[model samples]
Target chain A: MDIKEYKKYAENRSKRTSSLKNCVLAFIGGGIICVIGQVLFNLYSIFTIEEHAKLLTSASLIFLAGLFTGIGWFDVLAKIFGGGTLVPITGFANAIAAAAIDNKKEGFIAGVGAKMFIIAGSVIVYGVSFSILYGVAYYFYLLLI
Target chain B: MKNIIKFPEPVSIIQSASVVGKLEHEGPLGQYFDMYEDDIYFGKDSWEKAESEMCRRTLSTLLAKANMKYIDLDLVLAGDLLNQCIASSFGLLDCNAPFLGLYGACSTFAEGVIIGSNLCSTHQIDRCAALASSHFCSSERQFRFPIEYGGQRTPTSQNTVTGCGAFLLECTGYPPYITECVIGRIVDSGIKDQNNMGAAMAPATVDTLMRYFNDSGKSANDFDIISTGDLGKEGYEIACELLYKNRLDMWGKYTDCGMLMYDYKKQDVNSGASGCGCSAAIAASYFIDKLKNGCKDILLIGTGALLSPVSVLQKQNIPAVAHLIHISNSRN
Candidate 1:
């Protein structure tokens, strides 16, 4: 085939998948996760202080996400949910716990313990760095007000 | 000079061995493989080590079957998907013979056969060992994502087979022998999707196949089967459509090891099996054996997408190549 001929046809040959379905699924999945957190926050507030209840809400969600990652069900959710499942705190727990489960065969100290933070490491580093920047921005906003 | 070269003198496939993982063992052709390791680790600490051990076992098993030691062979040509081809290096490290490690990714097996054939026909070496291996976990962790990541895989995503194929080639042995080979040229269709490797490779496969046919002055009808390495279903369709456009019809005689790598309905493998082990395992264990007891000639083309994870990250289009080897069982 000629180079000129191929260049014309190449665009048609390549596949471009539709993103609408993934986006919709991700929206629903993210909403469900947030709703679960809200329910947990309300449930814990009756028994504990509001601040502790807020912390417990995130903890429970992370636990649930970790369980899903350990059992290999997180991928199923992530398959449909995509970024919706990936953007939340639960995704962070899934990342860390999944690494541990994946390396379980390699023994604890060398495998699970060492590899427990591969994906989550980057998220934590960026998350902390971004929070500091956000805090500075909020302080300036409060001063102006 | 064109890449197409004919070998008048037959290069013998004296012995072969295949070592496959459990997923492969569950496939239809599982019973035919030389060895099956239920454990992916094979008692090794890491997936890389397991891949190395898998290659080592294939080489050792082939030598034992042929009543020859590593010292008996003049050279060993090996390769794999690992960074720096370390898998092949460590896999065949204990062997006494001189080693030449190659990196053609999934096409390493075909490259081995081509180079091994050249060595044999030229009388540079009497006996040579050509081997390749790939582990799904090791390769995925190296190239794409961590298995624990549970990333969503598209339909175009191919599952790398955790297997190894080893062949002992000599100046003489069986009826089915290597007769011709076409070293493929890199044909970049400007395909950038790393997950759609088949699409990246299909153009190269078509280029090589067309060249082979043009050089031989015969269409696909001349060969019993025109088998490609790892095009799977998508790439397979693309290649066939391209062939049909060019007026060459395989007439359903075209097959791919990727498509044959697993039972599609029963297996969750997205786009069938790939990697150097994909074709090598199938050839060493199944097709080569079939050809040895067959009636006609066959053309085996091994395709590879020559892109590393770094290359993918850089957003470079994947360049691909497909090497061809002609095998004939006819002695007269």
Candidate 2:
């Protein structure tokens, strides 16, 4: 068969991942992480202002994710939770920490320092650019109003 | 003229050994492996070094098991799933033999055997060592995400096996000789998904199998076993169906090293095991034993997807190759 035909044939034969199952798992896993964040936010709010509590909650989650990555638990959790473990502050933290840990053996400069952002670099770049664009757009609208 | 090369005199596989990491040691074919390290690092500081160390141990075990020394080898043909094939070069650094580095992606092991056997059959080398290795951690960092990255594996994705296999081939020795081999040609099936490697590689497997059968005039029933290197589940199924459509029935005699490496029900390996080491370890340990134990003839086709990380990122289609090696118990 031709390449095009073979591609279609292979695609039909290969098993696809269940989107419904993944969505359910992601919903539950992401919900649990958010709940943890909410709990931390509430606990911090008991002793601090709303702004400080938010910052503290983010910090705590980042710390926990980095710790779990170091202990090699983050990957284990990731296998089960899939995208649920991602799309969170903790996931971003885990990505940085994991890259750092993976490259530690190569030393500080070329290894950990340079590659620490390998996975998160694209996210940061796009995220910051989009935010700046939104900020400029919002400023123009405010001036017109 | 056929592309197949038939040896005037069979090159004997004198000895073989396999070394694997913890996950592979816990696999279904765990007991068949010669040695395994509980530590994935193999007591090294990094995953790359760990892979090199695995290769070193595999060669050492092969030599030790054969009651031979490194000095006895005239040439060492080795490769791995590492950049520039550093795993083989650095791992076999201490071996005083002449070395030839090869790159065929996951088909490196079979490529090594084909070249090594050709050299041995031509009486150019008295003894040659063929080696290949791959480590999951190292491969992941280079090809996919970081080891600790929170990413989900697609159902069609395969787990790279952390293992190494070494085969000691001589011009003359015991049975289970390399009688014939066919070097594969690159074939592209327009598969862009890196996660579904099995699908990308299945067409190449079918291409090579068809060529081998057509040229050699051999039927599937003639061999005791016909196995592909690391096609995993999706590729294996696709290959079977494709071959069946072409009127070549490979149902009962067909199997894949990727499928044999792990237990589908128990192991969380989505599609199955892969990597260069997947086939190398299985062929070295399990199939070698089977050949030794009265299995008359066996055909091992090492399948490889030749897509680099850069190429895949650029959205290029994956090109694949499958090399065939005909191993038989008798020279005739």
Candidate 3:
């Protein structure tokens, strides 16, 4: 077979996924996670320093996501809920926790720590670089004004 | 024709066994496997070691079922989804027979049977054992990601099977013999996506099937069943279309070991089940059981993606191959 023809066949033979279903699941699941975070923030607001409420809510969501990942519930949710579980801070926590749990057999330092960032590594890299760029831009803006 | 090997002499598959880890036992073909593990690790500390243990169990179980000892085999053939075929080397360390460790990725078992059957038929060996195994944990860390890495898997991604299969072949057994094998050429589709292996591997599967049909002068409909290993759901569909385009027209009576090895899409196995264990375990356990139960003929095509982490990092395209063995319950 011609190389071009073969490439076309390779690319096109498989079935396409249902995007409509995925969008629906993501919308619903993501809404629920956001609601939980808001509830946590409200609950913490009444008890602790009002200034710490946002931090408390983030910490609570991360903790819960990590816990669910430890028990293998996060994967089930991720598979079914699609982007719902992954569009929040809870997903970030799940990534770190999942890597740690998966590599537990490989050992703490080399296996877990080394591979813990494979997926999340790109996110961290971009985050830091963008923050630095924004900081420099803000400083320049202040001087120019 | 040059790539096809014809076995004119008589040989037979004596017995076989399949051993799987925890998650696989919940799949559709769970009942067909000889045994399954409740523990993912198979009682080993490391995932690599556990994979080795899986190979060991299948080897022993096949021998026990055949009422034979390790010393009875003239040679032992095995492989795994690892860098060095270490699982087989470490797993069968105690066997006194000479070992030939092969690496055909997921198709290692078919490669084993092709070689083992030829040896027995040619009178070079009276009895030979062939086994292939893979573990999800060991394979994922080596080939793609750490199990703990929370990356979103594509719909095309397939879960590596945590299992192994063993086959004992001899000069003459109760039934079924491997008649011919069509060794595949390396077919590269220029696919660089490591996550979508099913698509990457489909072209090679088509190439081998075409070669087999042309060289053997047999139509695709001639076989009662045609099965490819570890192509999962998407790869299987693609290969079917490619077959039609190539003029073989193998549209029906086709199944994939990767799909059948599982209960079929119930597990969140992304695309489907994959790895060396997918074809090996399913062929040895499920297909053999079916043959014994009156399913007469089968074409077991072992397909594999020849890609390494280094190769993928170097931006090399994944080249794939498929080797086929024509098996039947009768000597006719």
How high is the CA lDDT of each candidate model? 0.86, 0.92, 0.85
Candidate 3: list runs displaced more than 4 Å: B148-152, B330-332
Name the candidate, 2 or 3, with the larger lDDT value: 2
lDDT of 2: 0.92
Residue B151 error for model 2, in Å? 0.8
How well is each residue in B98-136 modelled by candidate 2, as lDDT tens digits? 999988999999999999999999998899999999999
Give the per-residue lDDT of model 1 (tens digit) for A1-145. Answer: 6555654565466554468987888899999999999999999999999999999998899899988887778878887788889888877888888788777767899988988887788887898999999999999999999
Say which prediction, candidate 2 or candidate 3, comes out ahead on DockQ: 2
Number of the top-ranking candidate, with lDDT as the measure: 2
Off by over 4 Å in 2: none
Candidate 3 residue lDDT tens string, A1-145:
6667766766665455688988898899889999998898899999988679999999999999999888878877887787898889988888788777767766778877897876778899999999999999999999999
Q: Candidates ranked by DockQ, best first?
A: 2, 1, 3
As for candidate 1, its clashing pairs are none
Global Cα RMSD, each model? 3.1, 1.1, 2.6
**Which stretch of 10 consecutive residues in model 1 chain B shows the poorest summed lDDT?**
B144-153
The candidate maximizing TM-score is: 2
So what's the TM-score on candidate 1?
0.90
Using Cα atoms, each model's DockQ against the true complex is 0.39, 0.80, 0.38
lDDT of 3 by residue, B75-119 (tens): 999999898988899988887789999999877888999999898
